[model samples]
Target: MKFDLDDQQRDFASSIDAALGAADLPAAVRAWADGDTGPGRKVWSTLADLGVTALNVAEEHDGIGASPVDLVVALERLGYWCVPGPVTESVAVSPILLSSDERSAALAAGELVATVSASAQPRAVNADFAGLILVSDGQEVREGSAGEAHDSVDPSRKLFDVTATGDGWAADVALASEFGALAVAAQLVGAGQALLDASVEYAKQRTQFGRVIGSYQAIKHKLADVHIALELARPLVYGAALSLADRTPDTARDVSAAKVAAADAGLLAARSALQTHGAIGFTQEHDLGLLLLRVQALRSAWGTPTAHRRRLLEAL
Candidate 1:
C-alpha cells in the first residue's frame, strides 16, 4: 500500500538532480527562450554523459534500465530546469522495446530522440531533435528529415512536424495510445513538482508591508493549500506510474486522474507563485514568469484538465 524509492532509485534520482542543478538552468533557459537551438544544444553532450539520456531505455538495449521510479525521479530533475527533449516518448516506449519490429530499434539506443504527435492530427509533426517519431495517429512513420522546430512554450524542448511515411508495423495501437496518456501524465507531475518548489521558495523570500508576505494569514493559506495539493497529487502520480508499469487495468483511470491533478497543481502553484512575488514576478527578468508560461502550456498539452476530468467522471 506504500510507495517509496529504494536506495538505488534515490541515488540515481539524486545523480540526475545534481547534474541538472550543475547544468545552470537559468542560463540554459534564457538561451533557449531567445531561440537558441533547443536547450542550448551545448548541454546535450553533458546530459548524455550523465546517463540521463539512457535512464528509461531497456538495459538489454544499452540503456541503464532504470525502473519507473527511477524514470520519474530523473524526469523531476529534468523539469526542475525545464530542460527539454522526448522524455515522454522515451518513457512511453520503455515496454515496447522487444515487442516491435519497426525501426524502433534505433529508438532504444538513446543515441536518438523521439516524440509522438500531440494527437491523431494530420499536421504530421516530427519530434524535434528526435531521430525517431512515434506518430500516434501519424500518417508517416517513414524516416525523413524532421522539419525545423518553431517556438514552443517549453522551447528548451523543441517540437517538430514531420510526415509519417514508411510502412512500419505500428505497435499495439491500443497500448501505445494508453502509454501516450500515461507519458503526458508523467511529464505533468514533473512540472507540478517544479511549480511547488518555486511557490514555496517565493513565499519565503518575497516581503510586503515590511514583513515576510508568507507570514500573513492570506499568503499562509494559499501556500498551505498548494502544499496540500502537492501531497495529494504526488501519491496519485506515483500510483499512475506504477499502474502503467505493471499494466494494471485501472491504469487508464489512475493515469487520467494523475494527469488532471498534476495539471491543476502546476497551474495553481504557478499562479500562487506569481501572486506571492507580486508585480515583480510579472517582469520578464524574474524566473517566475517563465514558470507561469510553462505551467500554462503544460496544462493544455497531452490533454486539458476538463478533458481528463470528464473521462474520470465517466469511468465512475
Candidate 2:
C-alpha cells in the first residue's frame, strides 16, 4: 500500500491552501477574538463553497462522503490558516453523533455549525456561534444548549458549558473521540509547519551582528530540528487517518500515538518560533502571536499529550 497522499489529495490540499492564503486570516482571527464573527464567518463561507464542510457527512445527507484522509487534508489547511470556530466539531465529530438527516444536511450545506461536549471533555467550543449543540455521555448523545462562555488562551477559541436537555440516542462516544483526536493531530501538524515556515522567513531577513540570522549555525540547527519534528509527525497523522478510514483493529492506538507526536512537534515549533522572533513574538500585534497561542491551545484540546502517551502505552 502507498504510504503517501495521491495526486488528487495533494491537489485538494493545494486548493484549500490557495483559498485560505487569499483571505485576511490574521484580521479574521482578530475579529473572531473580539466577538465579531462577521469576518471569520465570511472565511467559513469561502471554505464551505470549496466543499470543505461536506467532506465528512454521508452521501444520504447530501454530502460527498469523502474519506477520513480527505477530511484531514482539509483540516490541516484550516489549521495552517488559523481559521476560527468549531472546526473539528463541525467537520469530524458531528457527522457521527448527529442522527437527524436534516441537521446533517444543513451541516453539509454549511447552513449550520455545530459544537459538542462529552463526559471526558465537558466544554463545547465556540458554542455561541454554533447552530447545533450536543452533549454526550459515552453511550448516549443529546441535544444541548450553550451556557456560560469561558476565555481560552487563544481568544479565537471560546469554550462554553453545555446543558443536555432533550432525549438522547445511542452513539459511540469512543469512536467520536478518536476522530476528534485524529483531526486535532492533523491541525497540529499543519500549525507546526506554519510556525517553521515563519521562523525560517524571519531568520532569512533579520540581521544580527551585521549578518542575517539564518546564516548562523545556531539558528540553522534550531529551525532544522523544528523541520524534522514536523516531518516525523506528519506521516503519523496521515497514517492514523488512513487507519481510521479503513477501520483497522489498532485504530485507537494509532490515533493516540499520532496525537502525542503532533502535540510534541507543535509545542516545539511554537517555542522555537517565539525564541527566534524574540520579544516581538509575544506581542498581540505580531501575527506570529496568533499561531503561538493557537498551538498552545490545541496541544490540549482533544486530549493532553501526557494523556495520549499513557493511552498509547496502555494500548500496547
Candidate 3:
C-alpha cells in the first residue's frame, strides 16, 4: 500500500514551517524558560490561525476534525521548531479526552492552554500556563490544578504536581495515552531531524588538522547513521498514525514501537549533534543546547524508551 502525505497535508506542513520560521523561536523559548509565556503564546496563536490547534478536535467542538496523520504532520514541524509547552497534551490528547466539552472551542481558537496527567502519572507539564488541567486514573477524567513547580532538564518544560479539583467523567484513558505517545514520537522524529541538520551544517564548516570536519570519514559516518535512524523512525510514526486513524487492533503496539524507535533515534541525534559541535554544544549560549535538552526531556515524556521497549516486547 502507498504511504505518504497527500498534497493538502504537504501544503499544511509547509505553511507551518514558514510561519514558525519567521518567529524568533530561540528568543521565545528562552522567555518561556524564564517564566514568561507571552512570546510562546504568540507562536501558538500563529499555529492556531493556521488551524493546527483544531486538527484532532471534532467538528461538533468547532475543530478542524483532521485525521491523526494530519496531526502527526503538524506536530513534527512544531517539534522541529522546538515550540515549548505541553504540546502533546494540549494539541493531541486533550481533544480526545475532552471531546464533549465546550472548552475545546477555546483550544481551537488558541484562547486556552491545557495540561494533562494521565495513567497515574503524577506530574503535568506546563500546568502553570494551562487554563485547563486534566487528571485521569485510566478509567475516569477530572479537572485538576497545579500545585508546585519542579525543575526539568529542559527549563522550558515546566512540570507541576496536579491535584484533582472537580467532578469526574468516564474517558478512554488507554486511547488518550496512545495519542500522547504518538504525538511524542512524531516530535522526536522532528527534533532528531533538526539536530542532524545542525550537525551536518556544522560539520561542513568546522575544520581540524587543515581539513573541513565534513571531510573526515568518522564525522560523515556519524551523521549518516543519524539520518538513517531518523528516516526509519519516520515511517513507523506515520504508520502508527494511520493505525490510530483506522482504529486498528494493533494500534497500541504500533504506537509503542514508534515511540521506542523515535526516542532512540532522537537520543542518537542529540549525542551525535553534541559530538559534532564539540564542547560548544554543551554551553547555554549555543542553540544546539536547546534541541539537545529538548530531546532529552521528550525522550522520557509520555513514556520512556525502556517502557516502550517493554511494551513492544510484551506485544510480541
Candidate 4:
C-alpha cells in the first residue's frame, strides 16, 4: 500500500524544518551537554511556538489533537536537529499515556517537561531536566524519581535510572510502548537523513589525491547505500504511524519492524558519514559526533535491536 504523506503533511514538515533550521540547534545541543539548559530551552520555545509541543494533545484538553502522523513529522525534524530533551516521551508517549491527566494541558503548552520509561524498558531520557518521571509495567503507571544520572553515549542525552515511588494510574502500557518505539524510529530516520546530508556535503568539499572525495567510487557508493537504506526505513516508520492511528492489530509488530529498520539505517549512516569525514569526524569539535552518538543511543532506546528482531519474528 502507498503511504505517501499528503500535501498538507509535507507542508507542515517543511515548516518545522524551516523553524529548526533557524534555531541554531548545534549550539543548543552543546549547551545541553554542558548542563546549561538555557539555549536548549530557547530552542524548545521555538518548537512550542510552532505548536509542536501540543501535537498529540486532544482538543478538549487545549491541544491541537494532532494525529500520530503529525507527531512523527514533528519528531523527525527534532531528530534531524538533534534537539536535546525528553522529546520521545513528551511529544509522542505522554499524551497517549496521560490523556485524562491534568498535566496533559501543561505538557501540551510546554510548561511541564516529563519523562517516561516502561518497567520492561527502564531507561529515562533527560530525566534530570524533566518535571515528572513515570514508569509503567504494562498495566499500571507510577510516579517515579530519577535515581542517578547515567551518561548516555549521546552526550546530549541525560539518561537516568528511575524507580517507582508509588502508583500513579492505570493506562494501556502496550499501546504506549508501541507508540514510543514508533516515535523513536521516526527520529532515527531523521538523524539518518542528517548524516547522509552532511556526508554528501562533506564529500563535495574534501579532496583526496587532488580530486573531490565525492568523485571517488568508494565514497559515492557508501553515501548512496546509506541514502537508499534510510529511504526504505522511512516508509516503515510512516506505516507504523498509520497503524497506530488506525489501532491495527499489527501495531506492535509494525512498530518493532520500523524501529529495527530505522535504527539499523541510522547506524549505517553514522558509520558511513564518519568514514567519509575520516579524522575530522572523530573529533569533538565537529558536529558529526553529535548525530553519531545520538544514533548510537537511540538504537536501543525503546527496545534493543535484538528485542525488536525477536518481536518481528514472533509476529511472522
lDDT string for model 1 (1-316, tens) is 7778789778876777777777776777777656564454556555667776666555666666665556566666666567655555554552352243333344444456556663522222225555556554432233334665655665454556665565554445455555555555555656666766776777688777888777899988987788788678778877877886788888778878987887777777777777777788768677766667766766766667887888889887
lDDT of 1 at 83: 65
Residue 111 Cα positional deviation in candidate 3, in Å, after optimal superposition? 0.7
- Over 4 Å off, model 4: none
Model 4 residue 4 distance off true place after TM-score fit, in angstroms: 1.9
lDDT of 4 by residue, 211-301 (tens): 9999999999999999899989998898888899999999889999999999999999999999999989978789999999989999988
Residue-level lDDT of model 2, residues 1-316, one tens digit each, is 6587889989999999898999989999999999999998998898889999989888999998999889899888888989999999888999888855468998988999999998646899999999999898878999999889999999999999999997998877788888899989889898999999999999999999999999999999999999999989988998998899899999989999999999999999999999999999988789999999999989998888988899899989
What is the descending TM-score order?
3, 2, 4, 1
Best by lDDT: 3
Q: Weakest 10 consecutive residues, lDDT, candidate 4?
A: 112-121
Can you write out model 3's per-residue Cα lDDT over 1-316, one digit (the tens) per residue?
Answer: 8798889999999999999999989899999999899999999899899998988888988899998999999999999999988899999998888868888999888888889998624699999888999998868889998898899999999889988988888877888899999999999999999999999999989989999999999999999999999999999999999999999989989999999999999999999999999999988788889999999999998988888888899988
Worst 10 residues of 1 by lDDT: 118-127
Q: Which regions in candidate 2 have their CA more than 4 angstroms from the true location?
A: none
For candidate 2, list the clashing residue pairs, or say none.
none
**CA-lDDT, candidates in order:** 0.63, 0.90, 0.91, 0.88
